[model samples]
Target: MNKFILIAAVFLLTGCPGPMDPVPQEYPAQARLVDNKVCITVPARAGDKIFSVQFGTESGREIYKTFGQPDQQLPVVQGQCLPTFDFQFKPGERYAAYYKLTNPHTGPGKLFAARFSLEKSENGHLQLKQYSRSEY
Candidate 1:
């Protein structure tokens, strides 16, 4: 009886996940064209930082440059995450934006990439359109 109880206890404990397990972190971001520049916006969280931003053509032929700072920073909420980064890039053409987000508390970072394009409206205005985005 004692041996069976001990085996059952071990199996139950090992089979179930603990409440202290760390949850996977997700970093969501968006991109658009503002005044002929690509503006990348990312939600900010405590201890989370944008490591790098790389811009290139949709074909991935040429990479322009890598940036580390955002052109604008919004206010950080106390307990809520808000869009706090605005990285602007003057591509002057269709391009893709790639970024990496990291957190010290987490083990590794996540990679996010997005492609965008611009179209002229009937009113003779440039409009920004995002093709697709992927997270890895």
Candidate 2:
């Protein structure tokens, strides 16, 4: 009886996880064209930090010079690291830009979206859509 009561007390002390609790899933890197900039969403473990985001050609040529400077440390809200920046490219022009998101401890994570383009809506507003992201 004492063992059963102790177990019950332990369970009560540690509350159960509610629906709002964050779950650990396959959190891959993502990208989207917002306004005149390309925004990338990179997710890491709770305590992990994203050092920098680098853009390169499809052939793996570094091209960070073409894009605007990124924020030193992107804001990680709701378990997502959002890093956004502008580039000097035409809207409809197809460019093979590959993104490399780096972490000091975890090496580097990559994402590539082919023919990256952002289209205008009928309302004349730029809409952000989920591009097909293949994690590398």
Candidate 3:
């Protein structure tokens, strides 16, 4: 009886194993400016989906200051899964694009931001250049 009690005490002290931490998943994306619009492309990943996108000239910190809300909230089509999405924007200007992605069975979601600018190419054509991207 004492041996059984000692074994029980050891087991309690060691503690039972708990659930392991989930591995972080990556959702790669790309953005570009075409004509007078900004195009964002996110390849389809297993169990990952983009639900919302926001565009603005402010930084991610500034946008988050406004409770993670931006002036231009792009519409996301429901029930339609597309790799590329385009929205109207002014050329020759710098802007930031925020994306909200989620795994249906996972927790809430994840937020990502990309900053880009337009520059004149050698051929006098406007070109889009992405500066930085962050996941939050």
Candidate 4:
């Protein structure tokens, strides 16, 4: 009886393994500006929807921002899912694009701090110039 009481007391003190350690957060998708367009890709088929897209240019060209959520997943090209946001860019300038994943199943629906940039090509068209993801 004493042993049973001691074991019960220990179990009470420790507390049942901490509520399953919280469901691991999942990130939905990522994007990059390629060929004057936003190219996005998800780790799984479920995270194909892009909730919001915002852009900034070196010239501060009017600050473009828009929201899009396709009823179905966009077509995959080169294994990367592309969103429908138009990439109207200012020529001969550098710009950054920010993205956020919307679908709940995908991890936290937060805007990734990574910025995708575009630069004017020699031919005077916006092309994928750089990509940066935030460590924080």
Top-TM-score candidate index: 1
Model 1 TM-score?
0.49
Which candidate has the top score in lDDT? 3
Q: Which tens-of-lDDT digit does each residue in 2-121 have in candidate 1?
A: 999999899788875667665544444566655554556665556665565466664454543433454432333333432313433333457666666656677576665666766667
When 2 and 3 are scored with TM-score, the better candidate is 3
RMSD after CA superposition, every candidate = 10.3, 13.9, 10.2, 10.0
Q: Per-residue alpha-carbon lDDT of model 3 for 8-124, expressed as tens digits?
A: 999779875545646444444566654534566654345655566556764322232222333333333433333334444445667776667666566766665567776677787
In order, the Cα lDDT scores of the candidates are: 0.55, 0.46, 0.56, 0.53
In candidate 2, the residue pairs with backbone N, CA or C atoms under 3 Å apart (3 or more residues apart, or in different chains) clash, namely none
Each prediction's TM-score versus the true structure: 0.49, 0.40, 0.47, 0.46
Residue 24 CA displacement from its true place in model 4, Å: 16
Locate the minimum summed-lDDT window of 10 residues in model 4.
Answer: 69-78
- Over the full model, what C-alpha lDDT does candidate 2 score relative to the true structure? 0.46
Per-residue error (Å), model 3, residue 115: 0.9
